[model samples]
Target: MKNLANNVGVSTIGIATFFLTVVVVVLIEHFTTFNIFTLSFFIVFPAGALICGAAAASGYYFGALWLHRRPTILIFVQILLVAAIAQFAIYYGEYRLLDLGDGRMASDVVSFKDYLDVYLSSTHLRVGRGALDTGAVGNFGRVLAFTQFLGFIVGGIFVFVMLRVYPVCEQCARYLRILAKKTQLFSKQEDFTRFYDTVFEVPVDGPDFVTLMKWQQEKDEKAVRGTIQSETTLRGCPHCKTQRISQEIKVWGEKEFRDVPQLTRHLRIPDGIDLTSAFKTV
Candidate 1:
């Protein structure tokens, strides 16, 4: 998890951007009859949900980029908080725009309970439903809250999956740079020989007598080191100061060939064997 207090700057900027988006959406709804959903509930609710999701995704991206960590649970909670605040702002904006009675707006004097009653009544009218009691209105509010929360989750997951599947270096969390590509071939050789040698000798008499025997033996066996032939790519990560070598070994008994120009081939080593040592004669 991230230290929320330490990220106050980013959080503050994110909150401010969300509210700004909400205000623009509210103004558009107020001046024009633009309902996000054909069913009532005002355009503000869906607009707020979208803004909240976007804000949450941005938060997660920035957290990963700057802090090298994305705290999924914390970001989700932050999204919910942003959505709730946006909903309240939308309600308050609409309340001020509405004339309650005697040329007075609900923003001037209406209590929270009275606001809910008015808001729910308008919702019912827009949805073509009959009057709803306080209990029904409360239930509808919970359902709306739940749907908005789901929107935030969907947005967060979308961005998270994109980041994971993207071609990036695991260690540095940055894009990888291809350093080199080459193919190699490996070979081995063995040699064996049979020979005879004196096996033992015995003394028959202390002064002059001696005997000798011979035996057959195998010796001077030699084996060439196994060589690996492969096509390999060398990649480096600039951010984490690391390198990765990826190789695809050629199948055994395959003939090796160089596709590059002769000059280029001369400059590069063959895939599997080291030319300097392989060419040396013993």
Candidate 2:
């Protein structure tokens, strides 16, 4: 799963790069003097795909590393980085290619007005002319960049909330994880909750000596009638006043035989399982 997530994350970087490049090149084609690269650039799609894929792999590696620690922060950071870099490419494309001059502007580079033109401006529509212009393109471009910006922010929010979310691994060989500091099993207390008939194992400190010895004697007497009897242990949790129950479980044998082994689960709990003083018999 970690590998898959890293793959997706790195792919996102590549996707952002691809979009960034497109917005950059398109703006230049519409507004620049350099026609050489624009004419031949489409031919490089295969190359771009390969390069982007490799780059994405690298990005995935880095993101994978970063996410392991600060998942929430890294998620938003990638989105923010994509938005800012892609937008910068758009602005560069416009200035260098859209304006079609030497890519030089007499106005402030950072301000929106640097690319503004009266002819391109949409006010022409409200005033009646309505011929398509860079003003419209520029406006729409701003909208695209802003929308992506918000999406990036949202991805970050999702990661923050998911980290603490406990997924139930019910189908796993282990049944549940009690959230207590010391893990215990439900089976120990003979406390059969709603999910009975399901395979559940309690962590234990081995079977009690007296219990196992007593059961072994009973098994000898009833070998033909009801012979199968075994003893198990319960895990004692000192802090949480709980104990994980251990039960005799049947396992298939290789050649019509069997084995008995007490199993444990991946349960999480707040505290260790130990009975309260009243139940301790002390």
Candidate 3:
């Protein structure tokens, strides 16, 4: 149970962060010069599934608890509970910001943020439906700009919160691969890595992957002949759940820090494998 919560909780945080990022990234792509891949990864990824998966995992973790308490559809019930909770949070945030304490609707017509463009870029829009833009919030753009600044700070904090609370899916992945290699137990370890990398490697598309190994011939071959290394990164998500694998650039400073052989703890280089396939995981 502890393990499941830790696993799902951690995954939820990472997935939510990446998923939430899609909104900002999409808006950026829409307003800037970027590629389709960038837009797809940055904008379209549904991070909510991580939350869903976590909730499901939680139910599974407490197998007897759920079965004894809720029985018929225990896991499904837990998932619904989480869904309700998430919806409540999003709705509460929206209402807290937009709702006026009168018997009236919000100043904004619709919610779901589809009208961000209309709200943010609206300097002096000429209207067709009315003489002036009824949707206008005076000095709203400035307000939005300020909010955007706040959003980054909030997002940063949220990301930190997620990283701290969760298992650091990327980090956990390092150990999983190392363990897999050390055990050398599975027949399709190679296929597993390819799929796993697609799932965990710096994603370009959700930036994606699952089924650890599918038994395809190409996937099989790629594993056995692949170059190996314990890849350390914070980058993309492909088309599956992601582990944002970016390059960990070491920053220099005037005060030299001690090299205590400590930083290596988080990284692992497995033994008795192709050695080259460490990164690729075949």
lDDT of the candidates, in the order given: 0.45, 0.36, 0.34
lDDT by residue (tens digit), candidate 1, 1-282: 345554554456456655765566567667785533212244225544654456544554554444433344655566556644655566566666766559887767877668856565444223325534334344465466556656555554555555444345665566545665544343421111111011011221111211111111123422133333335455555565455544343333334443322212112222332222211210
Query: lDDT tens string, model 3, 1-282?
Result: 965565455445434533443433344334562311211112223233333323323432343232222222433344334433432233333333443457554535566453434445553323344535445445655454344333333333333333233322342232111122221112244643564345444323221221222223433433222222232332222222333332121212244322223222232222221222233443
Per-residue lDDT, model 1, residue 89, is 66
* lDDT preference between candidates 2 and 3, better one: 2
TM-score of each: 0.43, 0.27, 0.22
Candidate 3 global CA lDDT score: 0.34
What RMSD does model 2 have?
Answer: 18.8
Better of 2 and 3 by TM-score: 2
Top candidate, metric lDDT = 1
Worst 10 residues of 1 by lDDT: 191-200
RMSD of 1: 22.3
